[model samples]
Target: MPETGDAAPDFTVPLANGDVDSFTLSERLEDEAPVVLAFFPGAFTGVCTDEMCTFQDRLAAFNDLDATVYGVSRDSPFALNEFRNQNGLEFGLLSDYNKDVIADYDIEMDFADLGVYGVAKRSVFVVNGDVEVTYAWVSDDPGVEPDYDEVEAAVEDAA
Candidate 1:
């Protein structure tokens, strides 16, 4: 897993924001804005929905701090688009359908009972314009959520 002060691993993948587009982490870094990557297990689930909605509600505040937020999931781009539309999310979601990003980030989780494997472990990472991780949070329990205030503070400090 990437720790604070470590360089973030970059990846290019499909972004779902009601419309599909290419999203490149390194490219976003080039904009000199702090990037918040929230890795969720799946879409349309109770916890995932609530977590994403919370981020949506906090979108303006993050924007004011010059931070860009992205939700990362193993769902396909089409499903992610539907999830964004249904939740009225303002930020884009990256599709890690191939499961490569989750593996690269070392947050992969397995739900053996559900027969679901290699899903994200519900993580939040803050990477600054320098491509270094400013904050890192990972949860083994999918039921847990990140502390929004702490994440916001990390972005503020990164800025």
Candidate 2:
């Protein structure tokens, strides 16, 4: 897991909108705004749905903090589009289908377990524009979700 003060690894991935773009950790923090990068195992799962829905429901609070929220998973763009529409998600859910982002972040799961392969573990990273990781949470149990309050607090502190 990445600790506070460590530089965030920058990467670009395809979005559900079919646009290939890049997001650099340092560039994101340049405006002095914080960013919330939420990593989920996959789209359309019960836990993942609930977790993203939570973000959607509280989108205003996050916006009030002037933070940009990004949901990332190994699911393809098509799957992500369906998930976003079904959940009415307003934020961008990035598609990291190739697992490059996950590998760069070191969040890939073990292939031997549960027959699931090429998936990223549930985690969240709060990064500042300087590419520093202000806060991070990796779910101890893959099925569990991170505490939003904890994340919100971290964002507040970082802000």
Clashing pairs in 1: none
Clashing pairs in 2: 29-129
| Predicted candidate 2, C-alpha RMSD | 2.1
**In each prediction, how many residue pairs overlap at the backbone (N, C-alpha, C within less than 3 A)?**
0, 1
Residue lDDT tens for model 2, 29-146: 6774688999999898899999999999888988888887889999887788788888899888888888988888888885465788878889999997667899988875778989
The TM-score, computed over Cα atoms with residue i paired to residue i, of candidate 1 is: 0.98
TM-scores for candidates 1 onward, in order: 0.98, 0.89
TM-score of 2: 0.89
lDDT by residue for model 1 (12-83), tens: 999998889999999988884799999999999999999999999999989999899999999999999999
Which ranges in model 2 have alpha carbons more than 4 Å from their true place? Answer: 17-26, 111-114
**Which ranges in model 1 have alpha carbons more than 4 Å from their true place?**
none
